[model samples]
Target chain A: MFYFILDILGTIAFAISGVMVAMDKKLDVFGVFIVAFVTAVGGGTLRDVLIGQTPLFWLKDLTYIVTIIGAVIVAVVFRSRMSYFKRSLLLFDTLGIGLYTLVGVEKGLAVGLSPIMCVALGTITACFGGVTRDILCNEIPVIFRREIYATACILGGFGFFILRQLPLEETYSYATAILIIIVIRLLAVKFKLALPNIYKST
Target chain B: MFYFILDILGTIAFAISGVMVAMDKKLDVFGVFIVAFVTAVGGGTLRDVLIGQTPLFWLKDLTYIVTIIGAVIVAVVFRSRMSYFKRSLLLFDTLGIGLYTLVGVEKGLAVGLSPIMCVALGTITACFGGVTRDILCNEIPVIFRREIYATACILGGFGFFILRQLPLEETYSYATAILIIIVIRLLAVKFKLALPNIYKST
Candidate 1:
């Protein structure tokens, strides 16, 4: 139940972010909705697909669809006021990524993937939506370029595996994983930490 | 057996295209490989994921990987000669898309998707690799902006459905569908046909 609520919140947060990007790009209404939908569901969809989960998580449940629509509506309606709520939005986005990382890791474990693959899955699930959004918006993916976002997810994924090996209950391990992601992301942003650029100019 | 060969050829073609794009972007060797891999496999990966296939096609088979690597190696070695081979490359790419479109549609049908959904799947399979490659190269997807590429696939998908409805052998239908895609794409390129922009500036 808790995870379900978190998933919905994450969807809304991601959708809102997508809306902001689409607005920035001056996309038409259809384009805005497409971007918002892709941003909200793209990562999870990819994760589910990799795990051989058919029909996708969102397609099976209409609630996610409704939630994204609600988010887009709110974004369009409160466009002018969004800047004032930036901090809160960031918090929501952070929470979303943390929750998604854990969910993705759990799904990977359920599918009996290797530990490394599970961690990769978790990071992909937590970051690929933003990647898709940025790509659609015609920009380099922020996670790949500017921020320590995916790194945080990878750390959290490792934490999840490590915690699972301990004597603690499964729920505790999951909580620890989520907490690790949230803390790392928060610290990275607060400190303005970034990964080294791999691109070399000729 | 025929499809398998076609799939390998298509992978080589797409990977070559990816290498070309990466070279144009002045990406390093690792970057070039990454782009090549994504361009060769991205569309089929998306299709597989949507249909709930696990571990991905390339993950199961090393042949695809080797093919991509070979393509990248050849591209790097013959970088200066690529412009002269543009016409042949176009033909190969067109063949790749046609074959991929049929494969995607067949997979979707086998998984019991609606015909329209299968057609959509076919178009995605035929085009998304290039979309992913372009995005990774930090460019807007040519298909979405200025090409009749995806349109040819859609038309071919429709042709597949129509041909299947006939009393001819299944192989004939499949061959006809692929031919339709190739012919349409070749014509579109030759005539410089493009979709009108849907993005309207306010």
Candidate 2:
């Protein structure tokens, strides 16, 4: 039940990011919807495919599509009002990353991947959609260039795995993972932290 | 032998397109190579995943990566001279589309998809990388707005299926499909053809 709620929340948060980019580009309605849908579901779809899950999640369930459309409508209607809540969007995006990272790691572990691969999957699931969205928007993925994006997810994934080994409650473990990720990410952003660029020549 | 030759040709042509785009964006060596590799194989990767092919093509055959790197290096070194061959890029792009469409249709049929689905897959395989490239470049996908882009692939797929039912040789059938696609696309471009924009408000 917690996973389900967080999944939907993450999807909504992702959709908002996509919609903002689309609006920034002055994309038409169809374009907006396309961007939003892809942003919301792209990571999960790639993860599922790599894990040999067929038909994909959105294809099987319409709720995701509905939620994306709902987000789009809200964005469209509240375009001006939503501008005032830019910080709130950041909060949701950060929270979504944490929630998605946990779910993705759990899914990877459920499929019997090694802990390393599970962490990789978790990070990919949290970041790849935004990567695709940024690529589609003709921008460098902020996650790729920014500090503590993938790193935060990896840390949180490890945190979840470690907590699972303890005698703690599931909710507590989940919340701990989310909190760890969110705190790290917020601090990174606030401090203007960045990973050193690998290719210094360019 | 034909499939292998066509595949290599398509890879080279697609690699050139990627290099050109990267150059236009003033990307460094790594960025150029990344774009070139994705452009060369992105469509096929998407198709393979959709069809449940494991490990992905590049993972199975590292040569594809080597080939794209070679193409990118050549383009970078000859960037000024290659700009003189703008018409050649058009020709190669068309040829790549023709070859990719045929390969995609064959793969779809091999996997037991319906004829319509096969044609859809063919069109997707031929144009999706370019679509991705354009989107990443902050432009609309030519396939979505161009009247004859994906249409040519669909027609070619249909031609292949139809010709196979006749007494034509395999080479003849394949050549016929390629010719049909190339001719249709070139004529459409020459005539400035485009799909009707469905954006009522925009």
Tens-digit lDDT string for candidate 1 (B83-113): 8988988988999999999998998888777
Local lDDT at A105 for model 1: 84
Backbone clashes in model 1, listed as residue pairs: none
Q: On a 0 to 100 scale, what is the lDDT of residue A199 in model 2?
A: 82
lDDT tens digits, residue span A10-105, model 1: 898999899888777766554576578889888988887667688676644568777988898888878878888788888888889999988888
Candidate DockQ values, in order, are: 0.17, 0.11
- Write down the worst ten-residue block by lDDT for model 1 chain A: A25-34
> How accurate locally is residue B124 in candidate 1, as Cα lDDT from 0 to 100?
77
- Measured by lDDT, the strongest candidate is 1
lDDT at position A172, candidate 1: 98
Q: What lDDT does candidate 2 reach at residue A44? A: 82
How far does residue B105 in candidate 2 sit from its true spot (Å)? 12
In order, what lDDT does every prediction score? 0.85, 0.81
List TM-scores of chain B, every candidate: 0.97, 0.91
Off by over 4 Å in 1: A1-37, A43-52, A57-131, A139-202, B200-202
